[model samples]
Target: MIKHRFSAFLLSALLLSTGVMAAQPDNVIRPVRGTIDSVKGNAVTITTRQGEKLEVALTNNTKVNSVSEAKISDIKPDSFIGTAAVQQADGSLKALEVHVFDPSLRGSGEGFNPFESADGNVNTMTNGTVGKLVNSHGRTMTVKVKDQQKTVIVPDDVPVVLIAPGSRNLLQPGTKVVLHGAKDDKGQWVVRGISAGKDGLTPPM
Candidate 1:
């Protein structure tokens, strides 16, 4: 009877360990963007451009950065850029926002991946170069990102921005922030890091 009890206990422990590991989040590659509605203690509330409200908990490990305004003319040929775009039915990407990386920041977070878009539609992040540009009808540019090329439509209203190092003090009401984090075991959003734009600058990536 003792041997059977010991076997049962071992099985239970194994199950518990498995559950613990499953509860923890894996690597975070999803992107979160919105306006800071409020900041209270270790929690921050944000309203996305799509009007979805998100309250993410902050931890001591959260990294923060600031962003500044940029111009579309700044994007030259071979200029490395990261943009979050929504795929359209016509097989083109509509630029939600664009981030022009400095020469020193080239190749940072390079690749295409699924992102948490503000509109709740499937979105992707493309990090690459401006292969070609056209002036007819707003702005059309062909971007070579990763191993693929996407024709991006840059509307007149899209905001372009530049990235700069920032601090936690940037987390104030009305500030724009792009968050990257994971959900905890309780299904609560926990921030790993944040990029808050300064003076109305939006974090495009």
Candidate 2:
């Protein structure tokens, strides 16, 4: 009985040590999505779509980028796009941000999963092509990937942006922004990089 107890204790201690070792800081990136409430110098206050307010400090090294405007006509059949959207009660997808991906990145990270949308809810991400498009009453797009398809509603207000270079001056009040931040050892949320959209678009990635 004594030997058995000692062996069990040793096993528990080894497991605990391994867990602590596994938790080493590996440059993890946490996503921050919300609307720009205000900006004072290097500090930015954002009211998340969920109503939670977060303040992030921008350093001189923070990478900033923005999504330019695109028209509904820009979205064509077979054009690859990834939309962060919320499903409506009527079973239709309402787009928050529609990202037009270049042909080089086609079929990348293609699936539906819970996404942290700027509007605060468990949204869905559909990455594929415009298998079908209707624009008479309102715009609707069907995204097809492999054997699956997701129908997304694209309102005129939603911002569409192609991948391009951006600057920090784009971080203005009312601009939708998403950032990847990390908590420092002092428990401060340090923003590593920020991705902002022109007016209404949330960062697609």
Candidate 3:
């Protein structure tokens, strides 16, 4: 059941990353990506990419996941993965980043959905099992989501990473992270899940 819970958390995180907001004004959830400035007790100071400094508090229920650098070779025919991609003129999707999920979290977020990047580019997020791989021209693969499938072209320069369960110990200063949460009544950020970089690797998606 732990894997199921983790999958749910990943789906929630992905939704926040895609800029989805709650209909209720009081329950607005968003994603924040930045570098850690400091950590004190349960509070974390983050320096946003825009040069803004924000302090967020982590609760006992906050989930932590580590993202580490990975290679395209790690993706096999049956590997479950998620990729943010832009649709090309030819109707094929070009990957911006590819993240390989842990085996236990195979079906997390499993489907194609519209996505907007931090820079305002509209894309799509595909999370599913790999059906086939073709290396001609570039690395291309067929991703199956339920009965639906998408063809994604992964460029040689696209970032590839792996996600795994992590802990508070990975919350050190200087690390890059993507936080999914909302602000509380006190106007303080309340973190729900933290996707932290490991070994100097940054969370690409």
Q: For each candidate, what TM-score against the reference?
A: 0.65, 0.55, 0.79
> 12-85, model 3: which lDDT tens digit per residue?
77764643222222222235778999999999999876677888899999989899999888877999999888
lDDT of 1 by residue, 32-142 (tens): 678999989998999877577788999988877678888877767788888888888999988898888767768767887776555555578778888898866656899
| lDDT of candidates 1 onward, in order | 0.77, 0.73, 0.82
Candidate 2 C-alpha lDDT tens digits along 1-205: 9999999887767754642112223322226677898999988998865577778788888877667667767788899888888888987789987888667667755777667564445577778888889886457989886788888999887777774446778989999887776656765667777778876765655
Arranged by TM-score, best first: 3, 1, 2
Tell me the deviation in Å of residue 166 in model 2: 6.1
| lDDT for 196 (candidate 2) | 84
- Give candidate 1's error at residue 180 in angstroms: 0.9
lDDT of 3: 0.82
Q: Model 1 residue 79 lDDT?
A: 80
| CA RMSD of each candidate after superposition | 8.6, 8.7, 9.6
Error of 1 at 142 (Å): 2.8
**Model 2 spans with C-alpha error above 4 angstroms:** 1-30, 34-65, 165-176, 181-194, 198-205
Q: After superposition, which runs of candidate 3 have C-alpha atoms over 4 Å from their true positions?
A: 1-30
For residue 107, give model 2's deviation from the true position in Å.
3.4
Clashing pairs in 3: none
The lDDT leader among the candidates is 3
Model 2: colliding residue pairs: none
